[model samples]
Target: MTTSVSEKVYRRGPFPVKFRCLEVLRVTPITPHVVRITLGGEDIQGFHSEGADDHVKVLFPEAGKQRPVIPTMGPTGPVLQPGEKKPDSRDYTPRRFDPVAGELDLDFVLHGSGPASSWAAQAKPGDMLGVGGPRGSLFVSNDFDWYLLAGDETAIPAIARRLEELPEGARAIVFIEVADASEEQKFSTRANMTLKWLHRDGAEAGSTDLLNQSIRTLDFPPGDYFAWVSGESLAMRPIRDYLLNERGTNKSWVRVTGYWKRGHADHVHDSKN
Candidate 1:
């Protein structure tokens, strides 16, 4: 029997959006510039995230505030309470979610002086943070013959999660770019993965063509493959174009995203083609 496209590509949920107030349970430094903050609380009871790239809006408290101001969930959507200021928030991938333990892990890359970076740098066990909505999930079937995963430091959390979730014997090729050799991360996965770490050495993030240049030289193995590429906005454009136009990758099987853009605060771009 021939496989149907819908059966191979699954999208689940427009889950009811829920905003939770979670407390930081621990802060672990993963690298010189990356920190992992694990959050847990009674509020984590109903959280759901199945997609490797699922995102949650992390609301940060304003200066002098003990906790972030959360919005009311209305029939239409999140409604701001009257006279209340909306807290500063940024979208972040859910690195790991353990429902049995009611814990969620988020990895933060320390760069510049952004709100998220600043909050993570000094975060401790007692810190309170507001988290809202994975909203939905897009589950790409792992039955593909092989996979291509590429990104920079910001994309590591999602890439790591995906790699770990792949079943035994699955084939995966990964390309990751980081600030330097010191910023590289190791992952534990059952899949047969060929992983490469690209170092910018001392170059500024988003200012180099390292990811695109590296991808250009890859000699892909023959198979039905799923490609996922994400990183700096401008840097990702050429890589996305290369995969779709030059390599003739199926549009529906490729996912490209811009986790952030240079000079722009809290920016995210997604192309599903």
Candidate 2:
């Protein structure tokens, strides 16, 4: 596979990456379609997730099972018990982690009947959720003249974190698409930011070009800019190509990803920056 901008930024880590099992502390709804699950355990003491776009693999147990088969990290890699079936897993952003509280917040998009989604829908306090490494962090410097952040609902957690982390006087232009007007959210940021929200209305998720179309109409600010985008894989391709080929975004400063793929059962959103 070719190296992407994110890979260059994160590289092979000298950073510590460990797998930890977190017990659910609370489950809250952020939106009609988004669930915020707060988890905590002693295992979170040294948890490290420093990037706005960092992700962890969340493991879910088989139906009727009481717990996920959490793996123990071995010298070679994650090691499972003999004859134990591997659990279903999906990638998710670490929305927030409070070391003092030993708590971590992960937001899940409840859009289907998939294991992760189904698990989140009925999650309750005391449930154990297995989470593994972000392995490394791609720390995008906030030193750019301006920034561009775009994505669909699935990308909201990352987008929200980035907006909140920008320093005072920084500039960020954001574009996000959600199901409808009710899905819009307000973000707190010290940066001079402009947010544009797109609505899919009645259109099927991952089947519309709202994000691409919105970005296309923007009169972007001049100067060196860092762009971070992700959503459905195919939906993001043209946008990534546009930034790299048409807008001349420096390959090193732009990051694009496919958070999910329409019609695909698995959600492994790899970067294509």
For candidate 2, the per-residue lDDT at 253 reads 86
Task: For residues 1-273, write the lDDT of model 2, one tens digit per residue.
Answer: 223345324443535556677889999888888889999978777787778888898888788765789888788877899998888888899999888888899998888799989999999998888889887667777778899999998899899999999999899999998999988877889999988888888999889988888887788888888889999999889999898999887888888999999888776877765
Per-residue lDDT over 1-273 for candidate 1, one digit per residue giving the tens place of the 0 to 100 score: 223346656566668888898999999999999999999998899898888989999999887666898887999878987799888899999999999999999999988678999899888998999999897776778889999999999899889999999999999999999988899889989999999999888899999898898789988888899988899988888999999999998887888898888898979556656
lDDT of 1 at 80: 85
Q: What residue pairs clash in candidate 1, if any at all?
A: none
Clashing pairs in 2: none
Each candidate's TM vs. the true structure? 0.96, 0.93
lDDT of 1: 0.88
Per-candidate total of colliding backbone pairs = 0, 0
